[model samples]
Target chain A: MNDTVLVLSIASAIVAGTPILLAALGEIITERSGVMNLGVEGMMLVGGVVGFWAGVNTGSLTLALFLGGMAGVALALVHAVLAVSLRVDQTVSGLSLVIVGGGLSAFLGSSGDPSLLQSPNGLDVNPLFPQSLRDLPAVGPIVFGHDIVVYLAMLATVGAAYFLYRTPSGLSLRAVGEDPAAADAAGLNVVRIRYLATAVGGLGAGVGGAYLTLAVLGTWQNGVTAGLGWIAVALVILAGWRPGLALLGAYVFGGLRGLSFTLQLAEVDVPSDFLAMIPFVAAFIVVVAVSANPKRARRVAAPAALAQPYSREAR
Target chain B: MSRISVEPRAHGGAHVHLGVPVASLAVALLVGAVILAVAGNSAFEAYRTMFDASLNGWTAFSRTLTLATPLILTGLAAAVAFRMKIYNIGGEGQLYLGAIVSSWLALALPADLPKPLMLLVFLVGGALAGAFWASLAAIPRAYLNADEIITTLMLNFIALSLMNYLIFGSMTFWRDPSRQVPGGKKIPESAQLPALSGRLHAGIIIAIVCAVVLWWVLRQTSWGFQLRTIGDSPAAARYAGMSVSLKVLSVLAISGALAGLAGAIEVSGVTKGLEPRSLATDIGFTGIIVAVIARTNPLGVVPVAVFLAAIATSGTALQGIGIQVEVVFLLQGLIFLSVTAGEFFVTNRVSLSRPASTSASGTSTPGSDTAPVVS
Candidate 1:
């Protein structure tokens, strides 16, 4: 209830939501091109482990982030082969990818020195707003006092919104998801668009993984991502195939997540376990409920090829 | 006839139809080899050591069978649900429920009951319990048109926590009273499944029989016909007068039942009782890969289960050779990817021959289907 607590809560929410927002945006692009990369979690797992190990061993923060993104794209290429070229069931291929990712990440992190790499200090990354600006309003402190990734995450959302809704290629990508056969017939390079979009999606998801390790935990652990990948998947459902709306949903979920920690600190009566499960529970309830509403369903633009394998014979 | 008219022209671009799944396996194996070399062991010797530990002796072979039993059932669980175009991603959770129920039945029943009767009840009770648990997802899916993927997945975590809560928090049904280990009470000797060989148990035979029956049901029966129809095309199935809601529920229930049966057999046979930590074993998700590699065919589950079981048994064995168990874990993941991709070889091929197919590149959009003929 205090002003300080409220300010901190809002700040934490933005930070926590960064990963989900990044992943959702990437998934939006991939799905827009009629490819559902279920391996976001796997991509994240590989990214998290590889990035953490590489960064800590080399001690170059930038290299860590780069390796993390490449790790994601590397995993994405496997998905591209199965879901795109071979035209296997997108969902099956993706889920399988997650198993591979999770298992591999777990194996690599099971050993190795824990203290090899240090968490990057935010002092340099944080902005020094004039105390005068800090006094301006509640907005200044809550919005400006943060690390660099938080700002970039928001910028990426804006970029995704523009790319998905405003651009010509975006329209073509959406058209592919809506009807790949029709897109193909219309002279659209369906496979090319899907490949690039999926790879880009991987890049975004990888950044999310880096945010998790370098910003959130500052340490590597097996199964560190846990089920956050599923949360990202649920975010897509909640967003209803719209990238702009995903940002809002991620923030809301992130707020609930932050609130759970606050309640724990305050020693609130509610069990923290139940509270922590809120985002997933909320995602399930919101997506199913929204989809149930005829109005909401009509407004939401789910790609026709969300989970289906693309086959010329089927077409 | 003597001079073959002209050899049919193969598509120029059709050099390989095998996809990423296949490629990833090679990549994974290469990565594993690198890890092995890094670990100060010869990759070839380490693999040979793993095979020796897993498949060289009867003890290991029997252990593999014991492990394969549950995997086959879980794979069947995934395959059954998939045939109806449903994603029952919560097989892990469902298995937990079945294990809890079976353990409860083993403990509470009249201590004098015959073993065969007890086994039958245990199997049915566990399966029905799993079916009941799965119905939670199926009903929402049928009535609310909910995405089963999220619900089922969330339910798995819930199930895990619920089992932990019962044993670790409240209720004394299965919790061990004295032991410091995170475990549960042992099931009665009368309730336990009898082992058949060195380590193999009747669960293996039961799993095999179940696979055959499942294959028959899916391939030859009217229900199977209906299921395949719906899986291939929901719209067409609806027009054919099939009750979509009922079909979805039935398939998911059957799927849940098989998974539940797996839990029951494990509790009654090798595990001898359920434990708080038992749910963490990943027979469920691994089964999903098995089902996929087999292309959702029940009969194909046997080999897939055995191979995965061998890999699992050897995971610990790798530690004996100065390699981390994680290496085996990585290999399993890679194999899942490869097996999933290998399915293409058993089903379809790609050809880039006709201009019409290439026309897809020019259009920049998909061609609309005015009318699609039902195969």
Candidate 2:
């Protein structure tokens, strides 16, 4: 392949994979706290629409990204109240939360008039940092030539890995998820930990949604996020609940999807539609493949109290 | 707000169903009315407009009836699968398979065949196709204990993409070339489902009959008992010598067959030709809501299906009134959330005892410990 084609493939793959990576990382945290929020898709859709409108109106990409993250957190708040506070069925409540977010997103989206907006490339062409580094071929421009936000996103992945495993709060969070009753007896605030984890998870989901509208496609369309949110959910399962590996899983799935477009360009002659089904097909395959490793399977950290609603027992 | 208990008025020994289903439905409509009021639309006027558009004249009436037909079958499909604790979200896929098979059957039939016989072939052929399609996930779920929710959901997309490939890419038999819209060939005249009145067809009758038959099988037969037993408690069912794997497979197959039957009926009775967007109809998805609202009861599927059908039919009316087509989606979403939340009331009650609030029944969330005794 030509250098130009290779550069484009990497760039596109990063853009495509960024959302899933962000979402799966967020989910890893949420699940680590023993709460499985299935409303990721809904949260992402809300983020996409809200961020699209905010970016255009404020004429500030930064504000748009911030607002998108807030929107996701806002939706997550309702889920927290229902599943965490009210102690409702996690599956039903999460699904219902999806319904609410989806409906609200679509309705609010209708008023914004999606096509009447333009996306600003939130990037700078400056070659200031280490002149020698800029001169070192495509390993520089394609990867390092990206915007400041991409760098922040990558840093966030590392932060998440550390936050989940290295820190005391992370340990406490894991303890709660593993055994909420034990955590409660140990004097840990299980409810507060869950709420914080969920909100953070939603924030991650929002960033992912904004990445789709602002960086990748640069335009809005109805249901454009498609099933990417769901793919992220499946990614967590594929990652076996490790934040560090989730990044790799995201790129792998993202690369397969990106290659579908490249194959079309190369005239590989396979039905493009069939190739599009690769990620989902890959998701199922990965899940089945991972089933053989008992350690990995057992390591899948779902909070002991993940799906169950918590209502303290009376004395 | 004044607090009132949901207590029985009578004191004598009695057995009367509290009609949670009917009350919950009423609450949904009431909330819908309130939403319309908030949206600057007159609730009463909107209802009248909807009634007029969907059921005022014969044309409108038939449209309503036609819409409800597939919904009934799909609702039943969801009920059957959910009864086994298997959430078969791939109803859309099963529906597509049904349409594909029924369409092919229509094509292969002789021009001289009677309408009744052709209809039977289409229906049975559709059911078998649906069952066969559902097995894709059922096998893996039963054997591997794979998450049914994810597998079934992904399979829906696979099914749609598969059909799209067939009509748009490969399968020559189902393609209707003359049609600008990408769709399958129209069923021959002899194979078409006959109309009952205006545009309502015999498919409605067939769906209703099947629903009644299922209700009997579920409530009055040994097989139905077995399915529910497995559904309610798979471990206990296993201890009782029931084949859990077989039950899972059987329930999914039945669910798939019902969804497939809906697809066949739609093809023969309404569309007469399969198309890319035709199967994208919300019946499969909405049927889940219908099933939940009906509390997974077969007899309850009828009213819930019609109710969902009402909201769907009224969606076009909202479009005509300077509202986005997404309004229908919004209402649909609300229905889903409301029904899911409503199930909480039916199954579990929260009661908090304090100095001011003392009750032996359901109450608020801040309760300490009020789980009811089995005795």
Q: Top model by TM-score, which number?
A: 2
Docking class of 2: acceptable
Query: What is candidate 1's lDDT per residue for A1-315, written digit by digit as tens?
Result: 225667767767877888888888888888888898888888888888777777666767678778888888888888988888766678888887899888877777665443322234311233546656556556766776667677787888888889878999889988888888888889888778888989988887887887777666677666777677778888887888777788888888778877777776666766454665667677767767875797877778578877566655456
Highest-DockQ candidate:
2
| Candidate 2 TM-score over all chains jointly | 0.88
> For each prediction, how big is the interface RMSD?
4.2, 2.5
What DockQ do the predictions score, one after another?
Answer: 0.40, 0.44
Give TM-scores of chain A for all candidates. Answer: 0.90, 0.89
DockQ of 1: 0.40
User: Candidate 2 lDDT, tens digit per residue, A198-268?
Assistant: 89889888877876776666666656676788788878877777787888888777777788787766668
Which ranges in model 2 have alpha carbons more than 4 Å from their true place? A1-4, A112-136, A292-296, A299-304, B1-47, B55-58, B350-375
Best-fitting candidate, measured by lDDT?
A: 1
TM-score for all models, in order of appearance = 0.87, 0.88
Per-residue lDDT value at A211 in model 1: 73
Per-residue CA lDDT of model 2 for B133-218, tens digit only, reads 88877887787676676777667767777778878876487897777867788788887887888768898888889889999999
* Alpha-carbon lDDT, every model: 0.77, 0.75
